[model samples]
Target: MKNYSILSVTCLIFASLLLVLGCKDDTSGQQNAAGQQLAMSLPVVEIPTKTLTAYVTYPASIEGVVNSEVRAKVAGYITDVLVDEGQKVNRGETLFKLETQSLNQDAAAAAANVNAAEVEVEKLKPLVDKNIISEVQLETAKAQLQQAKSSYNSIVANIDYANIKSPVDGYVGDVRLRKGTLVSPTNQTPLTMVSDISQVYAYFSMNEKDYLNFIQNAEGATISQKIEKMPKVNLLLPNDSLFEEQGTIETINSQVDPNTGSISFRAKFDNPSRLLTNGNSGKIQVPKTFEDAVVVPKESTFERQGTTYVYKLDRENMATAASIVITQEIDNLYVVASGLKKGDRIVAKGVSQLRGATEIQPQEIPFDSIAQPIQKVFR
Candidate 1:
């Protein structure tokens, strides 16, 4: 009986030892798995600020100052097209030619008649002076000479119209006609279009309130002075890339567009190389006026229902979604003129997963190259 009791006790001790060992192994495995799941690194970024020039962007289109479509005035078969598409042409330069054989013959005939009448008038003048011819005869001869001279001039003008010429110096657009194509005088089908692209114009619109404010402020200001100190204009290309150069406001529309509730405005830019052609659409940023402002990265803000919100890091590194009031600046960035103060740590990125009073590990990200430049402006 004692041996049986001892055996049972030994068995209980062995089972306890086995259970303890299994627990230790399981705990160590859990620790290893957790260590492996940890993030390899935390994100860090550089933040700096400087004074930045601000711009207000709007949609705009480019147009040449001088644009025209060259047309044929006289009807005839197109004998030759002197200028090719995209070729540069100058004023009075022949662009195309029409066969003017019939017109040329008429001119020649008129010239002969004028010469014969003039000769008869000269002979009759002497005869009238000598009283060898009556005064009425001399008068009749002079009238005939005058009429012939008028006819000659008319035919000469018609012959000149046979050659098509460019009225301005510019690049030719499309050559719609070819040699031997019949063209009509009334139908002035363009040979091509020409434009003086040495300077380009940009047209844009402003809201009625903005337009009113501008005029009231610029009432006594000179256009040149206004342009020099006037709001800075930034031009963006079709690719959404901004032009390195800036432009100046040239003119404001005489009246507001009733249909659109906006006032139109124009800007001028020197395009010496003719780089900006007609019909290019892009965005223009115009800095109207200044105000005491605070700005933030647009990505950090969220919109819910009708309000805009941002996530801010508290002392405990907890993200709290806070409501903010903002005004749009250049690009997609926003100016948080209110609802944020200096030195507040706002989540500049990755705020979508966060909620109010949520505990989170904060990671800093580098300012994008585009965003980096704007930081300097704030300082």
Candidate 2:
């Protein structure tokens, strides 16, 4: 019995030592992975140097070059409606006709007075030639004849003014007057409107800061030269579609609005199809191109306290947090102004799991593959 007890104690001691050694081996294996093994394995790409274009969009108000209010020259009831709304009209085309019965009656009375004055002048001219009457008497009769003739001519002019005509070549707007509607030159309401929409002007404003930057960057010494060298601007319609025709900068307001601190700009566009009209609203996209710009993918960056940061790989393939300054922005990418240069390598993806100075197993890949995934971009 004593020998059996000794044997059990020996077996128990051996079992305890084996258990302790197994636990030590497990702890050592876990230690090997800490700082010794990479925290994450992610694809990395080198920065690309290429030309890129960034667009700045501004809201704009559109109007035709000519928008004229059609009004009546004389006071009278409309006798005839000649032109339809939205109809194309030429200069001096009759749009409406005013009642001329009263004007015609006045013209007849004036004509009779002119005839009577002519008779008096004829009778006096014979007497003057014979010196039967003083020369002054004939001269007085001639002056009276001239006055009557003037009255007659004035009446005829008023008759012609009864016909309302279009002042320019354009499309007519809402016709407010119909047959029997009384109108006059000084009436509060206009007969209609005419808009020459063969071309349109887009009006927009820029803040003083933006205005200064634009003028300084333009390639010219004088304002006129700068305007001429300005690139064409694109129009984005309300539907978020690009207008087929591009526009050119026409003029800039010499003075800025003191209250708004903004300067006005106008751009002209050809509207051959007459699709654009007065009161249309749209956006103008001004393009700015950068040459040999260093660009980085937005997917590889994260913002900290309003500052953007990216994880760049060091010589030892460890992660290093870098601060980059962005000058312009394009789709899913940023045009780097500073902090990084061409051929610098950065972690492309899986950056949320990493921290600064951590070791990483880098899987080198093409920049496009990381920035623009084929599934997202192509599809």
Candidate 3:
């Protein structure tokens, strides 16, 4: 009976061991199935092949195309000031009146002298013809008349100049001299300045390389005409704000500035709204050549160890980080020059949690939808 009990105990222990092994197998199978289900549910995005444009950007300043300094042309005291600072004046409009007391008296005297000389010359002509007066006397009277005419003309010119007028229709700047200030022809005083802001000028300097390229390609064409094919220029104002008015390329300097080592180029813009101003510092946009490039969302790109990289979604719905060479930027898009291929599935989202060769369930967020805020640039 004791031998039978020992065999029974061994059988029980064998059955118990089998049960433990079965439980472990079942647990392992359950874990594997769960993992497979999770993998299937992961999101993935397909790579896209898109065309992009290559552009070059630089810094530029805003300047007036027509700038003039209003200076006194005649010597006189400024008696009446007709315009104020920031007021617009038309060409030939009187901006100020100089005291004309001495000029008027001189003109009156000239006129009296001219009348008397004409009478004397007429009387002498008859006398000379009748031999009552010598030929020399007639010649002297004629000469006196001519002198009087010249004096009259000179006085008239001074009288006209007493009324200072604007040379062109423009906005008046600061009043350099107040009324009643004595000014002269040789004086360095300027009463005020008027600038034609209807169309302002912007000057910039480009390197010799750019100048050569521009001249070669822009043969027989004006800078304004060339810039018309490009996007409008943006202006940065003194207050650090952007001006809404767009500008165009206007002129190029005939010669490059020797001191600056660059050729000067100018731009113009319609300032009908009086929004733009002179001496404002801002940058402009220039269109360049087109290159075969890949553009990715700025958000999808990340930097590590001074290198730029982007996450790509593989066919197996896994997140893969790729090292890419960035060239230029357009708004929120990055122009990729190398290290990524067209139609290579890229992870456009979840970059914060991504790493190189990471196993993930990639969700295909439509690139358009992901970059909708920035994609609005097209619409």
Candidate 4:
């Protein structure tokens, strides 16, 4: 029995030592994990207060100040084409000459009738003065002469109409007629088009909702007053290049097109280089400037269930999920409307790898380093 008790005691002592060793191993493992959790490496940015401009781009149709379709007034075969496409022309410049041979023949016959009527009037005048014939006969001869003169004038006008002239000082558009092609006022196609592009007009449409908002935001007591106070706009050419010259909003349609549910707007842009041509399509960028707005990088924000959030680093370098109300989105940046202010630091990148309340190792970067240049944003 004593041997049995001694063996039992030895077994208890061995089990106790094993339990102590297991506890020490678990404590050491926890300590090692805590020590390894150094601050997470994250690029951060301080919220900045600056003037930010937000723009919305819409497709626009370019047109010259004047787009005149030069059509033939008199029907005849095109005998000569005087101008080429893209040629700069002035008002009254002849663009095409039509064959007036038939017109000339008609004019010649009308002239013969005019001459015969003149001779008849002269022959009757002397007799009427001498009382050799009734006064009614001389009056009838005079009326015949008047009718002949009218016929001659009509034929002359038609002959003059054979010369097609440009109605404006502008560049020539597509020339649809060549020599031997017949054109006239009733023809469905025009001989060519003249576009006065010295100042070009860009036509764009704004939906009713946007139009109302735009006018409301503009500073003025009336619609016209608001339009006058609106800022200038920029154009994005078809090649994705920006136009050097800026444009101003000139006019808006009086009523919205019921079928389209949008109002048309015309913006005038000076085209000294003649780069903007008729029928050229591009985009118009209208910028709305926000002064002293709190801005943040859009990459730092994440959307959850339609709400946008970001990891904002506090004084202790701990990340807190902040829900920000954005007033506008400008390229890769956001203008914060609320929930954040200037001087608040945010994780510029790597926000997806962070969890709330976790500490961060901040790598601060300049605001411009993360966002586009201010001039580019507006330009």
Tens-digit lDDT track for model 2 on 144-195? 8899889889888888889888999999989877999988889988999999
TM-score ranking, best first: 2, 4, 3, 1
lDDT of 4: 0.90
lDDT (CA) per prediction: 0.76, 0.90, 0.75, 0.90
TM per prediction: 0.72, 0.88, 0.75, 0.85
TM-score for candidate 2: 0.88
The list of candidate 1 runs beyond 4 A from truth reads 1-50, 209-228, 288-292, 296-305, 308-322, 329-334, 343-379
**Candidate 4 lDDT over residue span 193-242, tens digit each:** 99999999999999999988888889989879878988999999888999
Over 128-148, each residue of candidate 3 has an lDDT whose tens digit, in order, gives: 889998999999989999999
Better of 2 and 4 by TM-score: 2
Candidate 1 displacement at residue 310 in angstroms: 5.4
lDDT of 1 by residue, 1-379 (tens): 9999999999999999999999999999999999777322222223233244466678999988888987777788999888787788899999888899999899889999999999999888888888897999989988999999999998888778888888898888878789999887667566678988778899999898877666666635665565456665788998868776678887777787889989888988888766788888889887644354466667677899988987766787666788888655545456665777756766776667665576666676654532543334443
The number of clashing residue pairs in each candidate reads: 6, 0, 7, 0
